[model samples]
Target: MHIRRLAAGLGAAALLLLTAPAAGGAPAVDPVTLDGPGQITDQVGALGSRKPDVEDALRRLDTEHGVQLFVAYVRNFAGRGAQDWADATATKNGLGQNDVLLAVATRDRQYAVSAATDSGFTEDQIREVNATAIEPALRQNDWAGAAIGGADGLGAVLAGDPVPAPAITPGPANPGGDGGAEQFTASDVIIPVVAVGGAGAAALYLFSSRRRKRKDTGGGEPAGWGGDGGAPPVTPLPELDDRAKQLLVETDDAIRTSQEELGFAAAQFGEATAAPFDQAVTSAKEELTRAFRLRQQLDDAYPEDDATRRAMLEEIVHRCTEANKRLDAESASFDQLRQMVTKAPEVLANAEAAAARLPERITAAETALTAMTGEYAESAVTAIAGHPAEARDRLQFATQHLGEARTALDAGDGNTAAVHVRAAEGAVDQAETLAGAVLRREGELREAAAKTAAAIRDTQADLADARGMVTGTRQDESTADLRGRIGRAESVLAEVGREVAAGRYDPLSVLRRVEEADAGLEEALTGAREREDGERRASALLDQALLTARSEVDAARDFITTHRGGIGTRARTRLHEAERHLDQAESLGATDPATALQHAQRADQLGEEARRLAEDDVSGYGGFGGPVPMGGGLNTGMLGGLILGGMLGGGGRRGGGFGGGFGGGFNPGSFGGAGTTGRMGGGGRF
Candidate 1:
């Protein structure tokens, strides 16, 4: 298809070339010649030239697009020899491609354009120009256009003298003859052409002029010059120029006002006055108003000079900066005041400390009463230690509860002061339990460290043993014993490392196997080495063991820490219990303000109980009847049930009668009666 279309176009162009007229005859007049820089000379020469190129171009137009065009000039005229002398003149004068053409003849101007017949520059083009430009131009004696316009062949009629009609000499009519040959005069064409052209040009000029005058007189910027489409940047408004400058001055005034207000506020703040903030806020507000006004002025200016605008913008920034500084200072002062209130609890603690340590009346009174419940006992200790000012009375009450419990225990009244003592003990138990967790964590950590040291020793032993085995075994040895042992041990260790990373950290099981492997290798190597090098080899092996042990400890510590924070069953259950019990305790403890000790103790008891229970059960406990044991975080699907003993139990009870592992650690109902040390409500009558 593409080839077919191309061939068709080529054929049409060829047909055009074939149809062009021969250019063998000499021109009727020497073709007007232009040699230099004006297009007029070339234009005239182009029209007047007998050159085959020009004639061929015209013939091509005629054959292709069906247009006959003619050029007109006075006889014996000569000017220049180039193609477009007028265009050459404009080019030499440093004008642009789109600037006015330089062709002139008499008083009127002219233009020239080149066209292909495909462009439809035709005889109709001439008729239209005669109507549009030629007749009018001639009546106005537009000689320049008459000459250049005609030479350019751009649809223009040349001026010609009107000829008077000859007297009619009617010859005797032959059988087939027409009456006569009609003679056309120029007047018949020129009058209507001139009238229509003049009226159209006048109406256009009048309408455009009136609209422009209206826009100017009505105080609008001229639309034609530059509308909102960004023809060029327009000047700023004159009315707002002074307003913009005044805005800067006013902003200075606002700054002064704010400064004055700040000074007043600062003086008040120094005097420990509460009203300073309000005054400072008011001043800041005024400054903000001034800033907004200044911004408005800037906006009204529309566009401004760079220097003045920069100065204005800078002044606005300065005002804002100053206002913010004042606000910051005020905020700092307010924060200091707020800190006094926020630190009340700490201050109260200090006050209680001073009172308790002194041989003061409050401490003496507190000492007079006590309670004997483990809960009360523990609370007594915490109160004694903390000596929180707000809690001093509560502590005194706790001491009383302790005294009561001790009396009941002595008198064999097991229930006496039991609830209070237990409540108090729960508080103490929490601290102790927390301390236990820390200790257990530390012990676990140490045990882990030891395990890691042992593992490292094993790896080093294995590595060393591998070295020894490989050392003794020739590279060509086919024995599977040495490489098989080393490869198996390395694989096991790598598996252990992955388990540790994945939070299935089974230190006991993994370490036991590792220890067995190391022992077997050490024993095997010991006899061989001793036989080979006596004690010297032992010393080197021992040194390597020491380094291996250290590295193992370090690696294990890092492994535990990296995996410790991950979601584990025990940690998740504990965290959930903490959140739940804290929320519950906070809700329940707010009642009975005078019995604040009882309420707060109950709340604390509940929370600590929840936490201890969560850890001790190691089995899942339902939170507000939600699903049991939110499984150990990420790897819960696998090891979660094993660690937390599955979520099958209800009522916070340990699951399934396990003996020593998880559920055996705590029995809350029995715990309440057993006088458990560090437990809430233990050894107390509830």
Candidate 2:
């Protein structure tokens, strides 16, 4: 069949050679010379007898489907990629809105296909034809076969037929049997003539000879030949001058608002209220400066070249956006700091009131400890004695920090005051927990034991459910570690149970261990459950994202078709990229749902951007404006100020205002028992 086709076109082949340039020098071919709106230009001459057939097919398709198809055959793409060459040629030739171009670099063995907005074929159809038909034939060194197969496949798809499989045959073997020139029919002579003229044919012969020599030495695919499809249309730059100017104005306003807030905070709260706010103000100032520089650059850049201008404008937008965000955060921080400064004195009074009652509470704890010691032997009630002693020590520490907090507040150091207050509060909480536990053990031993047992059982049930969720799924190290922790907790619970059964158990001790074990088990169970639920949720999200992405791609494609003239090159390119990403998301959905979601989200974003650009709706800086007033709160420093007065005045035994002389290790189970210690008598701030 191949031989017959080659033989029948002998006459056309002769005419092609008759037009060839005389042998001497093969002049360089300009890509523009061979590219036009509705024509197939064969610059490399690889089409041979098949050129007419491919051209006829394209012409017929255009006439019937309102689509234009252009084919280009080049000897080399120079240093340019196949996709780059195709895009440049398409743009330069002023290809029609409904045109498609198939560019093949025969010597380089690379090809790319590009389509205009109204081109009837979708990207998927183009990719399929390239993969199943054109690429296979090209890989086998059958140029005519690729051209014919690609044309047929594209035409069939346009006509609503499934793409046809490539019909390929081996090229003739080299005559010398030493891998010299491949045997060719008389028709082969005309291919080079049509491509580069007669002189070009001489150059072709020499080029073929060199290829054979290279093949003998180190054989590989032709220099540029590969399976890469062409890139999408280049994104044309939007008209960004007005957009940049608007963003600049908005950015300046944000900066001014931020500066005003900073000045107010410094004046009202003394420059040292909160270190974080101060740092944020400084950083925002720096960012504002950078934004100004970027704006200047944007202004200097000309929008004559759409690509360069768009890139410059995008940078400006990014810088301005970040500046605005930083400024807003700084302003909010200032407001919060101002409120805290205003409330400091009231907070101080409240702390003093609370401190006034601490001494009496300490006395009651001491009485309970003394009773526990009298009822049980010191050795038996050893655990209960330690907690109350530690509570006394923590109380002393809390007292000292409170006094320091007062000094800092008096000096207008709210940030320092707040830090001290937090430390004081933590110590107080620990002391209170220890004292309460000791008291509870002394008064309600039996009840505490029962509650501990119930907690253990509940935690066990939760652990079991968590274990069930991850039974067969692949488990990470964290999950495995959680399982081990749960097992340890169960072991601890069993030990507590054994002690209880033996009738020799210290109720306070047993209760403490049980609580610890329950906490650990509950934590482990929660972690495992969250891990399981997170994966399930991620998979579901990915599925929904993929569906949405597909819908977006379809909408973008439809918009391009309906408004071909209205859409710019950049928008059309973005739509193409959206489709590509959607395809990738679908492929990755099963194996990597998280990654799949990322791809789908990107697709959706690009699709929306394309639609926005096409509609010329790209003028605004869409971001946060000047800081709105968030509700205010008191600063931690004010609370610290209150703690200071209480610390200095509330004297207890041990010579510390509250926490002094409370230092001692308490056994976890020894709380709530009677023991004797020196009567609480410390009365000075530590």
Candidate 3:
């Protein structure tokens, strides 16, 4: 790290210290009062059965990394920024450096990740963790996952391992005028679909007119996804409005149906075979969450900004579009995996074929690992060290599942049979991939070593240039720093030389070390030439700028589209600003690339900022607003369809799903006929 970067880090700490006791604001909801330090205050009950998992993970983070993670879910941030509110909460709880607070405002759809000064993370790193690990999970309303991801990502930074990949960029601003949406008229596919009687399915849902009456802020004028988050259109466009509501119902119904199928699949085939489907469902749920949240905001009696409201509706439509797309994409794979229910013999036979090949693959992998170990250092092969063992384990797992499938076939339990066969197939396939990785890695490492050696030489030359510059009086204090940098680079080069000589070191590590050392030398050295792009013509720059601005805006839009449940107004506002700037830049066309570039740059900055703000909200949110109807019966009709978001009453009721719902839990089993077009109103969305 550079000296300037360190000072910035320290300054950040001081600022937080000075502002620890955040002042009160016009909070829409009261902040939860914490009793003490390191509290996992689940005021909103986000971490249901997974509380233990989060506790264990967080405990491990603190126990092993000397960092404390405190979490709180509240109604809203007391009318303050999520970060400020989090800081105040941490300070009020008497927390110090090495302490981080993940604060979430349930009703506000906002969150923040705040840490004390000495938490061993720069603001950038904090934001990175939030964006890469935490937000993706949080946006899905996987509250526990968000918390766990935070702990894992922070730990990875400390451990000097590669951090998780950055979250995917949000969909493009206009989302390419919506991708070619595949109309789904066929029964939504779930393997071994449970047959639910229509009357029984209807019996399960007691749509209390009163319960339905309350969440319907449209006063029964037709809302999107009826819930606490349901909202009516600002001005109805009959087709769009109908589509939005119908889509919400269909999407929600699809998610419910998919979840049921997933559970059954997981039970029979194990989680491995159903992993992809899980991701799709999870993604759809998050999208619906965003759609519902937007709907909720629209429904709120607050005075409206027409543009903002229109944007929200547009966003809702986009969200619904994406949710259905995800489900549709995975349908084929999901349906195929469920074939064991009807074709148990054939499925089992396929697994046996995979099972036979796996053993041979495992042996080859073991041989490859052994051969590589003799030629490379331990670090060089550390990545693939477990490949052989893992493959062997999966082979055994597959074999066991195969046996189970056969037994289920004998017992005439087709569903169970299908599950085991799918599990076997999945395990075998994974075993093959694991086995193959060993061979692939060996070649990759060999080539990387060669490339890395060349890079090392190039870096050595750069170090020498830096050393040459260190002798001048112009160096001043920087000269001393230059000497230190040269010394470090020299040491790295010498070590790499020895490794190259031995031909037995971690090539990846060597490459990274050399690169970092090179970067350090650059930072210490004086001036470099201006960026070449600056020399480009205004037209050229403007064209490039327009493209860049569009990309950033698109990404921000995609992120907001999916993760709307946890994001707040600032993110949406930021994205809107980005869009305006983008439009301005595009309006310039070729006439003013230079001027357009400026607007484009602003758009890019705001677009990224919008994403950052959204990530912050996701990381901070601890509430799972997906309503799980409890006793009293589900009033799931946003306008007419079943309400998936059991969240009816807003503001105070953050613990709707896990703690309890308006009605008793709306059993997915009760909605079983919903698995197909067999029941649950007509064939609209499902």
Candidate 4:
């Protein structure tokens, strides 16, 4: 049994789907339509405990008033587009069983509204729905909302008793004329209709009729759609119904025909004759675009507030559709003419007008799109300049041609104007490419200048640094070179000191011997300086002494040629042996002739060298000073010098009261025993 029932339900659904009429279908018959003055329909359903008045009203509308009533429960709003919503909307509206939905001429010149009813609605309730919801939705350009809200609000109104005063608000102001004084009325489509039960319906009928009469007689006030009263007068747009859109399309076609004729005439004028026809054509084309744009503006602006704006937009959409059709036809004609040289002037003129038309429209669209999308609108340049270089060139050429057109226009040469406008479009196309190239060049120049400036600064700094170095104003290469040399010399000195500390050699002994030689040379040189009269003789003696000193130094150099070798010179060896004997004799406090002789000879050699260098050498700056021996806690020198000769006779040995004091235990001068003859055990005295 359940399976059978399910199948029956499915069959019923299929039947309904096939039979249901489209939402915009023909006007419904009596009882299904909400029309006429003072006539109303009651829409209500049976509750658990149904009200008698509600049920009776439903029955009366269905039977006496020919109203149809129904009840529908839907799961979601998706059902709004379905037959369910249509039936539900009707059920919520009351209509006579035989009454039809309102029938207003589809091709009327004013706005019209109609509805169907499966559920009937009261007259007052329908008014309330139109005011509170339907009207507002329409004004705001919310068509779908207007439809759904009209249904919903109607339902709410019909579910209750009629109030003395309905809760409906007034409609928004009419931008085209005086607010409440303006009215839209029906025309001469006479169908005897039963009125609804309200003053509201009566008012609607009266207003509709008056508007229709005004339209027939062409007596309606000349007012633009905008509220600005001083605006140019505009003919009333066709009635906003389904067929209104078709009317707009027809109008668009008419406009294009007019433009084409004008353009042909314009071309003829350019043949070295009167150019009036060409002027007329250009003017006509411009006027056509202007008229189309104006219509769009009206459609967009009417219904001054949210209450009527939606209807206005819908009307505008129709206008746009019509305008687009005309545009397409004109464009196609232009394409055809473009292929023919005779019609080329007209084609070119049309293209120019089109180019001009797009800017304002695109701008307006961008603003609208921005508001709608909540993002930055595309730049005007981008929107108009199609793609790559082609877009740029087109725009550039167009602009240039426009300038030429303007010049021709100013000069009253319409033939030339047409030609120039064509050229301008081509110029417009090249603009983008030219602009890009210019920008690239500018960027490169700026970058090069920056690099040049930086390089200049760097060079200047380097020059300044070089100059500073020359004068020691800055620590430069020259200064650094001198510092490095000084630092190296100090390092060498330090290294030598360190070697002495580490016992690398008998440093003290070596130093003493070097000091003794240096001292004798100084003394001899000083004596040579004192004798001016015998300078030559003194210089000769000094020269002999210098040779002996040099010989001795040479002998020393040969004996101690290297640290790793034994003394190699015989003179150095014999002298060194004699010094040792003298040293032993000195330990016994005895003076030896042999040791004394060796010491004297060594001392004499060094002293003579000093004399020669100081007196005989002409390069000597002045006199030389002799060495001053320092005393210590040891015995004095025991080996006396062979002779002393400070104030004594020159060139001869002179005796002294103790010619030499005891030579000390260690004396640098005793390295070569001075005239020493004593052996250790055979010393004369101790």
What does the lDDT read for residue 372 in candidate 2? 64
lDDT of 1 by residue, 1-686 (tens): 32344345455544433332222221222333333332224332323333343345334433432233323222221243222433333233322111222232221122232221112123355344444433343334343333333333331221222212222222211211111212324553455456555654564466467657877788554444323442564345453344433433333323332333233334334544646765655565455445544455455537667667766656655555555455545543443442322233332233334334433433332333222112122322221221222133323333444455455445533322232233223222222222222223323333543556556555665566566667656665333565666766777777767766664353434554454455445444555554544244333333333233322222222212112212232222222233333334335333422132222223333333433333333223222232333232111221222222111112121111112122331111111001111100000000
What would the TM-scores of all predictions be? 0.20, 0.25, 0.34, 0.15
Which lDDT value does model 1 have at 568?
31
Per-residue lDDT of 603 in model 3: 83
What TM value does model 3 have?
0.34
lDDT of each: 0.35, 0.51, 0.57, 0.32
- TM-score-best of 2 and 3: 3
Judged by lDDT relative to the true structure, which candidate is superior, 2 or 3?
Answer: 3
Candidate 4 segments exceeding 4 Å error: 1-12, 16-303, 330-333, 340-686
- Per-residue accuracy of model 2 over 1-686 as CA lDDT, tens digit each: 32243334443555655544333223333355444444767665566666676677777765665455677766555567666667666655544334566777665556787653223344577878888777787777666666667777767876678888778763422111211124454566656655545544564465567667878989743342211442455433454555655565445433433443344345545667745665654565455445444444444435336566677667766666676565445443343453333354544444444445555666676788777666543433443354455456556666766786688688765433543443454445445545665565465544444455565565566567756755886889976876787777678778877876765565544554554554455445544456766455456556445544554555455334322322334555466567667878889988876677678877877776665564342122111122212112111122221221122212211111122222321111000001101111000000
Tens digit of per-residue lDDT, candidate 3, span 1-686: 22344345445544543333232222254545674544588765667677797888789887666566777766567677676677656545544334577876654557788763323455667777777777776556666777788788777876667567433223212111212223222242221122223322342243344436656765542234333454665555555555665556555555654665576567668898778888888878778767866665665569467667667778878897888777767654565565445667876886698689777777887787787788777855543455566566556656766787788688655544554564456445545655676677666666556667556765676677886776555757767888888988899899888987886776655665665566567555526423443323334435434544564566566444433434555566577567767877888765655567678778877776876676566545544444323122112122111121221112111011111122321111111111121100000000
Q: Which candidate wins on lDDT?
A: 3
Residue 525, model 4: lDDT of 36
Model 4: per-residue Cα lDDT at residue 90 = 37
Model 4 whole-model lDDT (C-alpha atoms): 0.32
